[model samples]
Each structure stands twice: as C-alpha cells, then as structure tokens.
Target: MKKIEAYIRHEAFEPIRLELLELGFPSLTISEVKGSGRQKGITERYRGAELTNWLRPKVKLECVVASGDVQTVVDAILKHARTGSIGDGKVFVLPVEEAYRIRTGESGEETLQAHPGVAQAAS
Candidate 1:
C-alpha cells in the first residue's frame, strides 16, 4: 500500500478530483492549506494597503491506494494540476503499512474494497 499526498493550486482541485474519479480513484481527502514555494508568496492589496509575503492558498489532497495504483493516481494529479507556472504544487508518495475499515472491521485489501463503487488496488 502507498499514500499519495499532493499540494496543489486551489483552482486546480476540482479538475484534479474529477480526473481522479474518472480513473476509478474516488476515496481521497482534501483540505484548504496555506503555504509558499519557490514563488515565496505574493503581494496583494487590502483596504488600500499592499500586503507582502502573504501565504498562498492551496489544496492538499491525500489518497491511499494499492501499490500498482500509485502511478495512475500520481499521473492523474499531475495531468490536472499543472498550470505552467510557479506554485503549481508538489506530490509525495509514502509507504502505508496497513489499512482498515472502521465500520465493518475489515482489514487490508478488504477494507479498501469496503467502499461501494470504489476500486481497490490490484494485489
């Protein structure tokens, strides 16, 4: 198992989600986040004043999938999130030792398949 985490531009979240769904990856997590990368934030105006170094709003996406699905999930994110500009975001993949479904007390691959209509990683 693997966990894929991505920090992406706020506006790109919807497109990324849709693409992931189309790829049969429907179980995921999303959160509103604030950070800066090489762009190092940007300047904005507020109440007739210039605000510098303001954090940029981003969307953080997390998904745990079977090992074979990692590449497909990563590709979907990249395809939908790229905007040909700085602050586009980054993706990270990490090891997942185990997974379980709380509702049904299912473990491992069974837990993943526990969700209706959700595709499980091919073991």
Candidate 2:
C-alpha cells in the first residue's frame, strides 16, 4: 500500500476532486494550506490595499491506494492540476505499512475499500 499526497492550488481543488471522482477515486482527505513556490506568493488588492508576499492558499489531498492505482491517481491529479503556471502544486508518493477500518474491524484492502471512494487498496 502507498499514500498519494497532492498539494494543489486552492482554486483548483474542486475541479481536481471532481476529476478524481470521475477516475474512480472517491476517497480523499482535503486540507486548507498556505505556502509558496517559485511564484513565491502573489499580489492582491483588497479594500484598496495592495497585498504583497501573500501566502497563497492551497489544498492538500491525501489518499491511500494500491500500487497499481498509484499511477492512475497521480495522473488524474497532474492531468487536472497542471496549468503551466506557477504554484500549480506538487504530488508525493510514500510507503504505507498498513491500514485498518475501525468500524468493521477490517484490515488491509478491506480498510481502504471502506473509504469514501474506493473498491480496495490492494494487499
């Protein structure tokens, strides 16, 4: 099993999530985050005041999936998240030793299948 973590632009979160659903990945966790990359933040105007060095808001998505699904999941994120613009975001794949479902006392693949949008996470 593995964990796919994607950090994406805040505005792109909804679209990305929808795309992921369409790709057969419904289980996901989203978090509101703030950071900067090459763009190093942006400029904005609010109440006639110009904002600089702003920490742009971003969305972090976490999901655990089978090894085979890793590429598919990553593709979904990159295909939808890419805008050829700065601060589009990044994706990281990490090793997940185990998983379990608390509700039914299921372990491994069953645990992942119990998640929101998934069939299984593989053994």
Candidate 3:
C-alpha cells in the first residue's frame, strides 16, 4: 500500500477533490494548513502594515491507496491542481504498511476502499 500526501493551494482543493472522486478513489483526509516552500512566503498588507514571511494557507490532502493506484492518483491531483504558477504545491508518496477500518474491521487494502460493499475502481 502507499500513502499519498499532497500540499496544494487552497483554491485547488475542490477541483482536485472532484477529480479524485471521478477517478473512483474517494477516501481522503483534508486539513487546513499554513506552510511555505521555495517561494518562502508572501507579503501582505494588514491595516496598512506590511506583513512579511507569513505562512500561506494551504490544503493538505492525505489518502492511502493500493500500490498500483499510486500513479493514477498522483496524476489526477496534478492535472487538477496545476495553476501555472509558483506555490502549486508538492505531492509525496510513502509506503503504508497497513490500514484498518475500525467499524467494519476491514484491514489492508480493504480499509482504503469504499464502504457498503461497493468495489470502487482504482481503489
């Protein structure tokens, strides 16, 4: 199994999410985060005062998928998240040993698949 972590611009979240669902990989965890990358940070005027080195608001998306589905998921994210600008964000893939669904007692890849016995494609 693999875990996909993507840090994307806040504005790109909805499109990426819709694309993921369309690709039949819907299980995901999202968080609102503030971070900076190569661009470091951006400056903004607040009450006539310039604020420098401020962390930008970003959306952190996390999902676990079968090893075979890693590239597909990554591609979907990239397709929907690009904005032809800096701070487009980054995607990271890591090995996931296992996953278990507490309520259903489903484990391994099953834990990442859709519930209600619906076998989703690319899961």
Cα lDDT of candidate 1 equals 0.83
- Worst 10-residue stretch by lDDT in candidate 1? 114-123
For candidate 2, lDDT tens digit of each residue in 1-123?
899999898777777778777666778999998887776856789999998976778899999998878998898889888999888889999999988887778788666654453533321
Worst 10 residues of 2 by lDDT: 114-123
Worst 10 residues of 3 by lDDT: 114-123
Q: Model 1, residue 76: what's the lDDT?
A: 87
lDDT of each: 0.83, 0.81, 0.86
Can you write out model 3's per-residue Cα lDDT over 1-123, one digit (the tens) per residue? Answer: 999999998888888887788777778899999887775777889999998975888899999999999999999999888888888999999999878899989899877767553334433
Clashes of each: 0, 1, 0
The C-alpha local distance difference test score for the whole of candidate 2 amounts to 0.81
Badly placed stretches (over 4 Å) of model 3 are 116-123
- The C-alpha TM-scores of every prediction are 0.86, 0.81, 0.86
* Model 1 lDDT, residue 86, Cα: 86
